[model samples]
Target chain A: MKHYREPSIEAAETGKPSRKGLVFLAGLTLLFSSCRLDMHDQPKYESYEASEFFADGQASRIPPEGTIPQGGLRQGELLYTGKMDGGDSELFPFPITQDTLVRGQDRYNIYCSPCHDKVGTGRGIIVRRGMKQPPSFHIARLREAPPGYFFDVMTNGFGAMFSYSSRVQPRDRWAIAAYIRALQLSQNASYGDVSEEDLEKLEEAATE
Target chain B: MAQLFHPNINILIRILVGVVVVLAAGLGLAYYQGYYSVYFSQVNVFREQPVMFSHKHHVNGLGIDCRYCHTSVEVSSSAGIPPTHTCMGCHSQVWTEAPILEPVRESYRTGTPLQWVRVHDLPDFVYFNHSIHVKKGVGCTTCHGQVDQMPLMMQVNTLFMGWCLECHRNPEDYVRPREEVFSVSWVPPSNQKELGRRLVEEYQIKSRTNCSSCHR
Candidate 1:
């Protein structure tokens, strides 16, 4: 206490603070500022950064064997695997209504249209840009291919095509497959496929 | 000391010292005020990247959707960065021999990923889910600003916790129709508050103010 008060008392009496004391205080402040070792630089693991703690040296740990996360118990065959017990299912897992078709169309336009093209002609912008052109949906082979086949392709991926499992959900995959079927029908359908009223409308449209 | 300073000189010296102190205080106040400003925060600062990719060229000129490159934004936590194949898809045909595209070509040739520098990086602790925000009908322009207009992608928002809470406090002001989620030029329609209220209920959007919502 005496040492602390001595300097200020001396300064007041002398009308000037000692330069030595000022220099010492400034040096102490500089040292304290420079010696910042805080929680910011504390030992912590960042995502995907190397870790010495883990034996494998990876910060990310693999999930335990047979561990299924919440809502991840994908039990049903058609729902999860896009196939029946034996092979690709002939029927859709759920009913495909007009709304479902619309959803499918929207999702397809967003995800599939990049490579499959709007009309499924296999000449999408990416294909034109130099990526390998996928087989057109209008092709007889693909037209005859079951809906499950398309689902499997989207789920498992085929050739250069990457699996869209993460991007497109299971139901949306079916929708996309339905849209592909619709595209196939649009290209391959004959005049007989049109209803009489629609035929007349088409004829009138052609005439006009 | 043989009269080192005259009385007037000493007075002038004291006045100058006072002025310096006042000026320093004024400067400190200005710095504090500008701490979160565009200049200090680097809000519109164009960050340089390995490749001089132009968002304006791809988004505005070519009319490419945001999802074209940032795929899985609707489903994944991250807006997925385009793989080398995606770049090669166009550059292979258009900029086949341009030296500017040499890095892209090299990536394609070697199958090594391009190291794109991230611009709008949040703190490590902040848990952000792109899908949840997109699904909740928040438009891309809400947080990202007019990215389509920028030639170089610059972080427009301050992205501070307070900035995030401003929206989370009342999401209706920012929420849009599902179709308008990706529309960069979308503005609130006339009945925005009403529509937003309806949507908040319909979508079950309870903007969680709990710190753990983002912190964990």
Candidate 2:
């Protein structure tokens, strides 16, 4: 019978490895490439204890009610009456400039048109689908209302409407009100029409 | 007789093994530290401010309210940073000499706002309402930490999504009286569960367990 001789170290090291080395390599590959074992997996709590709501140490220092410290109108005027007596003095207070009307129209289409309709007719999809119906802008009371009044209704919200104060800023709400006024006027123009010269100018502009 | 191994081949193997080990270690360190910057590169980490603005000084010391500076917090999506004019209201006379007050004065003169770094930041996707939380008796300190004590405020709690979910899931377990909104002092409830039950019954507080309450 022929005797088998052990391979020399030089022969063993010549190529990759023996069968045992290949098995070890495969095992290491599996071990290192395994799914991650995360240690900080425990869920973090918001740390809001019930005691936080109670008058505890520094937590008890509650701010006063309705304390808007910045450039807003006082609550009674800005929120209720829509007057900007104490609002930012530098900015134009809600009578609606020519540019504001254009901006207001754009904003109205984006926000109010979905619920109030483009024509201010109150027949929006939400209304048509049997949700709460908004009052038409064509009504005499709303048509005659000041721009500030409309702004107030938009901010603090009127009956059956939740406050848009969260969604719309003070200035944007005023802009929408301005646009609503424009819509009201357009639909209700009366016998006191444009002068002949003005009409001619408008006609000439249209031709151009 | 021994066969000679190439010196370059041995060096190449050693270099390859070293590179693999280093790459593995780096990946492991990043995973361990919760370094998810790669995934959320767009997320702006809430930053700490340079100067210490004291809520305690204004709100507690001078009897000013949170609304004075954060006027829009209750009514708008953002708490709204106070313009320089708001700070000039009192600082105009109060702390004219303080070195830290110089930045504030400059901002007012230039009609610029102080770049007060925000500390409490929720994820962009989550919708949190300050007015609803304030009105519902959730205290500012519940999320803001001890702002009165913080010299230069840092985020005390991890404002993670799970953190918000926990309180929102169990509001009564966390809700307290509206008046105690700012106090850090804890006075144990005589009846904990009873208070929770009462709030649930009286306030008609629909379960915050609903996903849409905070998620939407």
Candidate 3:
């Protein structure tokens, strides 16, 4: 049988020290495992106040007062009363001009063509797909409507139509109304007095 | 003694793991609860006007148009609120004894415009035009509910993006002619779809359904 011997003092001391070291290491590992760095999370930029954004103060140019031309009818007032007050002629002046018609056409394409169609036939895609269909500018009643009436409708909103008062400026709306009148005339133009030169140009265009 | 020593080491390790788990769980519970409680929620807390001055009353009731009070609504970007003197135009001679008129009187005397609370307010990001709506024959009631009936006006409708879109999607269904625009008695035609179609054809009306029409 092997002789029984007491454990070495050095070994016993080192054994205890090693055990404590192991325990400390375990504790440290647990602590470290619990902490995490969130590298993916980032800070976002915040929106600034209006004053800060427009620091130059140039953004606050208040428009001059009394800019709207006078003699225009106000809201709730009738457009035109069929009276021969000489004002009636001024209200719906005859002989629509080429430049006026062109301006009107430009305005119509921008504001009206999207829904009313370029020809003012109300066949715009918005209408074709069962959307709200606007009346043709070529219609008799609308064709006869006074400029003031168009101006009023554009200023206020008619049925289903909300007001453009906030969308189109007053002067621009007036321009658009003038354009609508021009559209009506173009659709209703008579071929009775066509010049030979005009007719020849039309024929040449058609042939092309 | 040897058995006891190894078990003690194991027990220490177990306790260390348990403490870390508990700490993590506690932190997670706190974080989730705070997140669900709307940690970043903020309320708009600005003071606004109090009385609901009727654009309808001044426009329709007395036949005073929008320009009469909001003098620059047409020409300018802002359809400005009328000054105290605008109220004193008629109130000084008309309803001098009324209780509500007291504020109007005080504002005039003090040279301060009555801080009449604005009700139909939109977000600053939105670009709304009073002139365009007015020009289009859009009744004031479309956005601002029936003001003639209200003494002190409350916001009648939610001026939300969705609410505006609802009308925009089908404008002619709600549109009335120029003559009936201001009249409270005005009613949408029975055949709204047909009427819309007719208006689009006859009046050369434009569609407001597009995003750029209102948003841009």
Q: Which of the numbered candidates is closest to the native, going by highest lDDT?
A: 1
TM-score of 2: 0.43
lDDT order, best first, reads: 1, 2, 3
In candidate 3, residue B208 scores what lDDT?
71
| Worst window of 10 by summed lDDT in candidate 1 chain A | A33-42
Location of the lowest summed lDDT over 10 successive residues in candidate 1 chain B = B86-95
Candidate 1, residues B72-150: lDDT per residue as tens digits? 7887788887877777655766668889889999988986566666677676777789999999998889999898898
Considering DockQ, which of the candidate structures 2 and 3 is the better prediction for this target? 3
Local accuracy of candidate 1 as per-residue lDDT tens digits, A1-208: 3555444667788988788888998877754653454532346664344568977665557799999989888888887777886788878899989888898898888778877888999887767766677898888888888889999998987866877776678988999888888888888889899999999999999999
- Candidate 2 lDDT at B70 equals 67
The predicted structure with the larger lDDT, 2 or 3, is 2
Per-prediction DockQ: 0.21, 0.02, 0.02
